[model samples]
Target: MPSSGETTTLASGHVAVPLEEEDEKRIFRNFPTFTDGASRLNPGRWLLLKGFKDVADRIYNFKLRESDVVIVTFPKSGTTWSQEVVWSMLHDPDLKGAPRSPLMDRPPYLEMEVDQWPTEVKFFVPPLFQAMCPGGDASRGTVVQMLEVEKEPRVIKTHLPLSLLPRDTLDKAKVVYVARNPKDLVTSFYEFSRTIKRLQFQGSLAEFADHFMRDELRYCPYWEHLREAWQKRNHPNLHFIFFEDLKKDSVREYRKLAGFLGSKLSEEQLARVMEHTSFSSMKGRDEALGKSDQMNSEGSFFRSGQTGSWKQKLSHDLESKIDAWTKENVADFGSDFKYFIS
Candidate 1:
């Protein structure tokens, strides 16, 4: 499926999976080491998780077409919500048929490494594979392997920051970046990392907040990630949306997205998209696609999808620290997008 010969079909009837050890080593060598010069998987910092290296390479080498729509976000920053909205906007509900599986199954998280997921999470991977593969046999191929074969105007998702992203892909395709306030982003990210074993971030909230402040967390130095995108907000091909803004009025944001994607929807069509992408609606429909089996104790992916949930979780001191840090890094950085820190 990989036109560039990046994928391999195995003799055992599998494809692009069980990556060769050599490839893993080669891919890691390309990623920048930690700021503290520690192991790549150092606590709080991002690591090249299992299957990440291969997916990263595939994303870099994969051809980019102008019609492609890429959903970029820092982890847990309303990515799933945006994906559902975009997917709904792109397809005709009656003609194309309602999504048989979850939005993740249809749009596909480009960097989602199913094989690399923790064992408990792997149980849910089979359902995702069934949705993607023809015969419902997950053994057919890897995540990227399936994406490599997808049709044009593909809706892809990624957590990569601008610097690490493939330039051509951003330049040619429609890029939608969704970011949330650092407080909520960190809270959600912390909860998500704690749930997903692969992230290896085991610690108290205070410790996690400290790590975040030091820019030691995955795709962090949150201000910088937001800053980079903010600078490019005016770019013709890019559309930037704030999570709080969407939370306040998803209909307006959805319409903005439709306009950006060049999808002209009738009033009735827009209403349908809004209803389908609602938090309660998503929670009710895609439980399997929301949180994996490993996170059964935690709850759904639509966990309290609100703007100020941080007030309940974050201590006053941590909130102050976040506010001060945001003021220094984001507000004082000459960012016109300072309101995003809300």
Candidate 2:
């Protein structure tokens, strides 16, 4: 068995063995599990397998470069928000003016499953990226489009754990990891879990806590993934930003990001990015309301976009369990992570 902190060495030596567990394989076997059935609440019409499935092994794999930028974060942890921020930092001027690119194309999501829309909902989102940029380089491929890719100065997004990515991705690429308070994560996850295809029903909040505590969900054991990037925070090419930090001082946060990306923006440009990238403003835009990222979603992928929202939904009893579970599961157990907010 691999040690907790061990970096997996693949047969090729350079490649790494991704941290795959039984639950992930199980979820792979029975994907698109349910849609508003007894097992699900936030349901989708169709679910397609990207990784751990048939084609992605060859299709989704990509070789990143030193100039590439990757935004890594746990699911629903301000992924779209961070993507928007990073995109605007580099391309704000271009995006702000006419012939602009939507958030997706300028800085795309790298490895997660692409959400395709149903025919009914598809009409709402008009290829926000393809239309906005329409740059000659844009290729409309599946998750695999990035496979074997060697894009310089590229910016992409991903939700996969650090162990799964190519070893040099960070070494070669600028990596930005976004983390949120576990309470908010778990709070968002409860609703997001309702959308996942497989899992045993634990009950309302308490029921799910058991699975979460046990790390039963695919892309789970969130703390380990968090630490994987957290440990690398000091790396030359890495930056880890907290959701709370952005929530507290977004204007300043954008400036910090602009600086990281080697772009300097005036207060006016920063204000515009902050305005459009604001959750409420983006929510009003057609893209998010329609799952503009292309995952055939019926509802807003950016639904109720905010921080500390977990408080409204998580039970006190469940919260206690989650706090304990997070402490136990975090890689260094009281050393590496700051899971609580206030």
Candidate 3:
């Protein structure tokens, strides 16, 4: 493995460097068994795939445009759902022109790099993505490179915390962050980890929760991620959303999102977007596109999209442990923060 700050020239001719290891001990210090393929990025100590090491500098220095709309979220926090809603608001309000292409192809993930994976692991990548970004092919370019050539007013998606983004991102772009209750988020993420072969997570839900609480999972230290965005909630260009709010009343959230993007949607258009992006609708779409097969997961990508569904899955002891952890971390975040856990 490359050491911290080691630079390498990728096939795309882009010079990339690994994240500087500020505290090696804290990087995957716990749960070394399950975290074999992950690493920590400096400054925030954010957990991410080892591939992020190759593109960290590129993402930090990425240029942003004023018209760009970036969707930021921790993994499995309704990212795909928000992407669909935001993309529709900006590009197809009427929902008539929405493309049949998968959402992953629509808003390019800012830090994704499939080329760095081992040859044995490469087969796990979805075929659609393989075709779009064939491994070791400089002509197609990395995801960040693809973003550079995309048309203006692009809608970009990322799981990166605010600290890793371009310094001028907020000044140059509109950012929408969606937060989910940790209970549901963790439940969804646990299921997702099991589905993705690359993660290599074979533990029980309880063990996964322990890792999550310890900030060992990818894009973890979950509360810290939320706190960064919470501090910047007042910024004019940053729009903060709760995943529960969308589940409770998507129409209202959709309107608020459209307004944030400065798009005026007629009632008909709003209804169309809501209908098209609903969880059931998206799941159906994913099935029609055979995304489940492509993902190599046993179930559909869009699992149950219910709020507070963790109550059904978590044991009493596990729930209490999670609650205590939540209380301790969010003590200083104010009462409004309770909305996320409640």
Candidate 4:
């Protein structure tokens, strides 16, 4: 529930999600020639996008407290995987596979809807995510909604770029931002856009790459998005991690995350979380596949969970274009962070 002065609940049952006038305009693309000036996202982007204009206001518009734990990412940048990691680390280490509760329940995607998801994937994915959660959605509310309401520390997820979300998401709470290589992100998003038809039909990978290089995808201006966060890397509460690094050293990333969260993990429990979340383990599995009930499997969320999958598909001209764009846009991002675009 939003505190006073922040939200307005409609008698019609429509949640008046809060937003500044500028943010409100982003929704126009959903209706007309909407473009955030990045790439146009596929319909899959709309899955959680529905309530952001209002429902999201039900959550994000409220003032944030220090205890809130949020995971922010540009779409297709291992947002889902980071959700799983935070969920596991924040809860009881003893609870293992087939959790006591669903994953979404514990630390739900502030935006993902489980009831609408397919039966198989949503049900199982929710559990792994939920086990870490103390009670789940029934008691609290949506992840962002709960974060707005709670004084205790909590874990939540978001795919909105920094500019679009309420500033409180940054100024007041702890932010865990994850990014993946653009080539990988491009390939993954192409697959993601197709999952939701509104993004555009799956054109040749070359066509998609052109859109990507041009920064026309949803939540795009990819380099700018990453750079915004990168500039804030020095924040004590901010943890910036890469998907490729997590792929190579899951435990290392886990430990780094735990340190930022101020949660301690035993070596064995750390190993278990890493092993369970491995890309190989998650691939084709019901949870990662997005085939389950939680989300529409139509466009597929887990697009080629491999790093270099781009090399096999991208051409030299496009690669150069991508390279040039990254240099112009991302040159200022910290050196510690490297993109897998090459």
- Maximum-TM-score candidate: 3
Error in Å for residue 207 of model 1: 1.2
1-342: candidate 1 lDDT, tens digit per residue: 111224433222223332234433333232232111111222223333434433454456566678889888987789988887887788762224754445656677665653235434532354555545656444433555566566665788877666545557668899999988788888887777566545435576777777677665545556767777788888988999999889887778888988999989888888888888889988888777667764646645667788878889999898888888776775544535635355
Ranking by TM-score: 3, 1, 2, 4
Model 2 error, position 75 (Å): 0.5
How many clashing pairs does model 4 include? 31
Candidates' RMSD to native: 8.7, 8.1, 5.1, 8.5
Off by over 4 Å in 2: 1-61, 98-106, 113-141, 144-152, 195-203, 287-299, 330-336, 340-342
lDDT of 1 at 189: 76
User: What's the lDDT for residue 273 in model 1?
Assistant: 82
Candidates in order have lDDT scores of 0.65, 0.57, 0.73, 0.58
Native-referenced Cα lDDT, model 2: 0.57
- On the 0 to 100 scale, the lDDT of residue 150 in model 4 is 37
Candidate 1: segments with Cα more than 4 A from true spot: 1-55, 93-96, 114-141, 197-201, 288-292, 331-335, 339-342
Clashing pairs counted in every model: 0, 11, 0, 31
1 or 3, greater by lDDT = 3
In model 3, the Cα lDDT at residue 209 comes to 89
lDDT of 2 by residue, 1-342 (tens): 321223322322222332334434433233243221111101110122222232223323466666677888877788878887776666554454633345555455554332322222321223543443444233344333433242345667777666655556766778888998877776566665444323222246665555556554545566766777787788877887888889898877788887887767888878888887898787777455345433333334556767777777877887777777765666463454567422
Candidate 4, residues 23-125, lDDT tens digits: the string is: 3343333323222211122322222232234444445454566777888888778876777777767765544453423443445465553322322323223
Model 2 residue 227 CA deviation (Å) reads: 0.9
Estimate, for each residue in 1-342, the C-alpha lDDT of model 3 and write its tens digit: 444445544333334434345333344343333332455555466666566555666667787889999999988899998998888887888767645356677788776653223434531234455555546344333665556666666899988788878778899999999998898888988887665544435678898888889887768779889999999998999999999888887878888988999989989999988999888888887775434443444644688988988999999999999988987888678777644344
As for TM-score, the candidate ahead, 2 or 3, is: 3
TM-score of each: 0.76, 0.70, 0.83, 0.69
- The collision pairs in model 1 are none
